[model samples]
Target: MDKFEQRLDQAARAAWLSYVGGRTQDEIASQLGVSRPGVQRLLALARQEGLVKVRIDHPIATCMMLSQQIGERFGLDFCDVVPVDTGTADSSYQYLAVAGAERLERYIERSAPLTLSLGSGRTVRAMVEALSRLDRPQHRFVSLVGNVARDGSSNRYDGIMVLADKTGGERFLLPAPVVAGSVEEKEAMLGQRLFHAVTDVALKAEAAFIGVGRIDRQAPLFQDHFINEGELDELLAMQAVGELLGWPMTQDGDVIDCSITRRVTSLPLELLRDQQLVALAGGREKAPAILAALRGGWLKGLVTDETAARFILDAES
Candidate 1:
């Protein structure tokens, strides 16, 4: 073989042994009958001459790129895009739960006390469940949504209690139904001293994690029986696309001024907007809702999957 060909072959072998075979420089040198420095030079030559190629086998690399693109496009401070699990029919919740738990861990691990607000939904519940148990009694958790439904049953997806249990932190839950019977009832409930006290603490939270719900027949509000069929139809007729913390909004992310909104007992969206609200939602069915929230600037951060992220970016484009 020619001198050039011999050098190239040696470099390729060294590169393969060092990178692909995970061999140390000393080990590679011994195998190739060269000094450790000579092995290093061969590896460097392989890289410089394009004889070695590196590729990440995991999907997180792609997800990170998508996260950056989405963050830049929406002017968000934080964004997490989880890999799409194509094998499963619906893996949005699975991946989002793990990613959301990791995100929450960052705040809970801090030693200083922090007040975190929470919104209820299957996604949020899943996230709480996925979180590892930690003793963070210095922190506090407050629910941004009421714990009760219209039928007097507890909201199944409410996660504040679970979060409190997991973290050993204090808990504050709104002592009213998700939606009151009437505006007068809502006003009376809101005026109560206990409710006022809870909201005061909620308003001062450092950050909040919420879930986005699409407004439709299958909306969480409708499915959970928080809102009746008539209310759902009204929201649909009003061009509502999504909801955050039970406040329905149009495609532009403007909260709809409907009777249902007036009866919603949760903290006002206007107030929540002033806080650092990060939404955890994904799935193709929720892309439009997620887009609306993004466009409306309702979220400072978002944790979603690549499928939904692509849809949101495409819709914005």
Candidate 2:
């Protein structure tokens, strides 16, 4: 475009012919009818003039292929696979969360009366952090599951509040526990005006992002005392592999409903039917839980690592 740029391009071509083409500078100079010193000067000009630009092309094909496979397997709207260059799961999860947050910001633009049902998990924590940096107009943010537990270790309230504040959205906090003590307590809490309002928000949510919780001894929700031992045993007995919106689901993603010691969930399976429920998770250990969430039909979108994506596609096959 400019004289300097044109000179740089010429120099770059000369450099390519001399170096990359395996020709010595003297040979290139002879072929191009230029002196050996002149060829060296051209190579120097190529670098000094900045004729090269470097960029990393993300493996979008891998993401799209995985997304299509998972979408077809679970009948979801779409799946987003984030490339994990690092071997660590934390970095991989962060990349996926950031991608999901960006995707959500765009989705919010196209969709109106957007009610967002947020979750609390490692992946969600990262998503909230990433989502906070994005600029967006005011909308409604709903807490799909209770943010606190009896022991009060993990606080998802801060994460949700951060996202809502950053997006200029209204926060609808769920007042009840994630898992109630008894059926009467569950009904009583759900009957309250405050809890009812949150449920209403969940029912009206245009898009919901939930995290799959594993049914294991090291489960975060369980370790945090969000659910009692009895409920955990019940879920394990029912062969539940994962949780969605605080509800137990089998490995195949079927909702496991029966007598349980505690139940405190905002949106039921039927209510989540038509809404966009995106499930974010990673790791081979979470595969069963992720699969369960898919089978339950609670996922409209999914963001995960390549390892999990391959496993999911292979599992279906």
Candidate 3:
């Protein structure tokens, strides 16, 4: 377009023709009516200015390492690694979220009836925000967990709506709480036709996305006081380190079965065997939960920052 850039681009093309196209430098010089040395100088300039930028691409070794480690550890399908940006936790998470969203888009394009289960966490929230930027025409989004919080601050329905609207598909909102007060209450809710239909939609999902929650914080397992204190206490006593799709998972990524979790109608981890289960997370604070989730086999695919990746590897090793 401009003089220097135009000349530089021309020089790059000429050089590539000479070196890569198997044309001798003398032949190229004769064709262009320039001296062989002149052609060499042009090639050098192209390299210096990065006009002839050469890309050597292979699967990222680090990603493969982690993916293979996780897959073998948990028996998963695949894993993707996003490079860690050396910066604040928020920015690192932002990079992970964007990459995770891109990966999700690719997966949706390849898979069908995506059984998406979103978790309520800052990391997951960021991932959903990133996904909102992508344009996809078809894909079903399901809320793997209940939306209402005990205090009513946030819910899964909001997240499910964001995902469904972005992907241009209907969202199935789980009306029941993620954790229920009683097995009977959970059973009764399932008995209702509306909730049963929603649960059916969730169970048939082909892919799911989730986030891990810490044990210290009172996670919004159910939107509004649906899961009782006794159940939460029991989960803690089971040494539960985190949760995925409303299931309490231990430090080793094993799901803890309190009577309440068993009664909940959410899809079980074992059911996710052939499905694409992706977990997006970041921060050193979440290393235990993330590693546990990986070790426990929560994710067949993972998107995370470098800091968290290192932490997961270190903790696992």
CA-lDDT, candidates in order: 0.87, 0.73, 0.68
Q: Which regions in candidate 3 have their CA more than 4 angstroms from the true location?
A: 1-75, 83-87, 110-117, 132-137, 151-157, 218-233, 259-265
For model 3, residues 29-130, the per-residue Cα lDDT tens digits are: 888778899888888886655444332246678766765675565556665566666555556766666667666667656434455666555666666666
Q: TM per model?
A: 0.79, 0.75, 0.67
Best by TM-score: 1
What's the true lDDT of residue 239 in model 2? Answer: 86
**Once superposed on the true structure, which residue ranges of model 2 sit more than 4 Å away at CA?**
1-57, 110-113, 132-137, 151-156
Report the lDDT of model 2 for residue 20.
Answer: 68
lDDT of 2 by residue, 1-317 (tens): 59967667669888788656878888878877778998888988765443332223565887778877887877777787776555566566767677777666676564355667787677886676665234455678878877756654546555568777767778887776677767887888877888887788778887777788888877766887766687677778888777776777777777777665246555676777888778888777787788777766678888887777877778877
Using lDDT as the yardstick, the better of models 2 and 3 is: 2
Question: Which scores higher on lDDT, 1 or 3?
Answer: 1
- Kindly report which residue pairs in candidate 1 clash with one another: none
Winning candidate number (lDDT): 1
RMSD of each: 13.9, 11.5, 11.2
What stretches of model 1 exceed 4 Å from their correct place?
A: 1-59, 155-157
